[model samples]
Target: MFPLERQQKIMDLLKLKKVLKISELTEELNISVDTLRRDLNTLTKQEKIEKIYGGVKLVESKFAESSMDERMVSHLEEKERIALKCTEFIQDGDCIYLDSGSTTYQIAKYIKHFKNLTVVTNSIPVVNELMNSSVELVIIGGKIRLNEQSVVAYDYIFNFDQLNILKAFLCASGITVEKGISDYNLEEAITRKKIIDMSKEIYVAADSTKFGKDVTVSIASLDKIDVLVTDANLNKNMIQKFRKTNTKLIIAEGP
Candidate 1:
């Protein structure tokens, strides 16, 4: 197979089942260990996969550690759908906290012209998105974490803890019943949990792919979420499981 195709296959396998050993790749992909090694090397260079002792693992770091540009490509159509779904929970004259994520940022796009709305966010890009709007904007001030492209240390914790929030949109690395809402960064998780705790209603903005994934830290339990807006591609059983919770699940693609 072509190199790009092979790399894509490797990523797919890793994403589907986390880490993959060399022998496993050989058995499944019908390729030699050497070819697999080359594939791993190539993907590693591309920052898609990280090479482990005897296998390869998908890159799990959301911020790539300490890089300044914490940019990523999300499932765009799904994010837009979720954004639309979010509007259902929002009423006029509501004060909301928007967490930093590609999906949450999508929500910002939909809220630009919204009246009687207040937005408090840590993302610089998010602030830029809503700055021109008539909606009241409150930019959380803190130590700017370039990697996540957010403010997490000071402004979000001390400054925001004083305010009463009506609603919050939380983005997660994984939204599992087992682990609750988890994120790659500790500070980010803390910020999200704090926001949820402060808000009268908490809504999780995530894509279906985020379900069942695992992260290092837990922000809050599934019971803490009042609403979840996600893509329609979530597994039916899993979606039903989430539906059984106190949280209301809203599919973005609609009926």
Candidate 2:
């Protein structure tokens, strides 16, 4: 297989088992141990996976699962405003899952005050914010992606599968009425799809600026989103587009 094909397969395998031994990868890929190690090392540097003593493992986190710092700085204010409104869905004693992104990071800040809740996530920043909160914080163990400073892998999903998620707050790089929600990074896309699939009610926290954009990977349909929280700058026609579906859209006034 070509390098891209090989890398895709490796990503697939990581999703299945969360961890891979170098020898096992060599046998499966019909490559030398050195080549397999090289691949693993390259992926590790990219923050796609973690190189353990004798194997590799996927990064496990729910929020900002694969993003870089530059993207986080793009729309800080809009994200925070939407995140504040997204917190309305969170209640005490609820088990919440937050997918990582610049917007979702704000959601973390807004929900930290809820008592007796369990915040499950894979974002390093989210963990940093709520680590001292009264809420129960369960950090999913996995490899860390450097670009997004988020975590991905079956390891996180396996744990999320065991939980009863009350609300899942997600963020995306793109949200189109026709094409649905999208994200650029492959690692982020996989984890966001898993978040929407595994949660009971999916709450999307995004800015109005993201409305017409579409990206490489389609993670969720606009129809599948249970609630959308955004700042008040949304155009009227677009609001009608979301209204065409049963999805509940909530717009917040500027902060």
Task: Please report the candidate that would top lDDT against the real structure.
Answer: 1
Taking every candidate in turn, the Cα RMSD to the unseen true structure, in Å, is: 8.8, 13.1
> After best superposition, candidate 2 residue 241: deviation in angstroms?
1.6
Q: Could you tell me the lDDT of residue 36 within candidate 2?
A: 76
Encode model 1's per-residue lDDT on 149-197: one tens digit a residue: 7888465346666777898988887888766788778888877877887
Question: Who wins the TM-score comparison?
Answer: 1
lDDT of each: 0.78, 0.77
lDDT of 2 by residue, 1-255 (tens): 877687778989988776667777888899987777777777878888766546766764433333344345445666777887777778888998877677887787777678799988878888888887787987666668876677886763456577777788888777888888888778778877877887889988888877877877889887788988887888999888887877888898884
Candidate 1 wrong stretches, greater than 4 Å: 1-72, 155-157
TM-score of each: 0.72, 0.69
How does candidate 2 fare on TM-score?
0.69
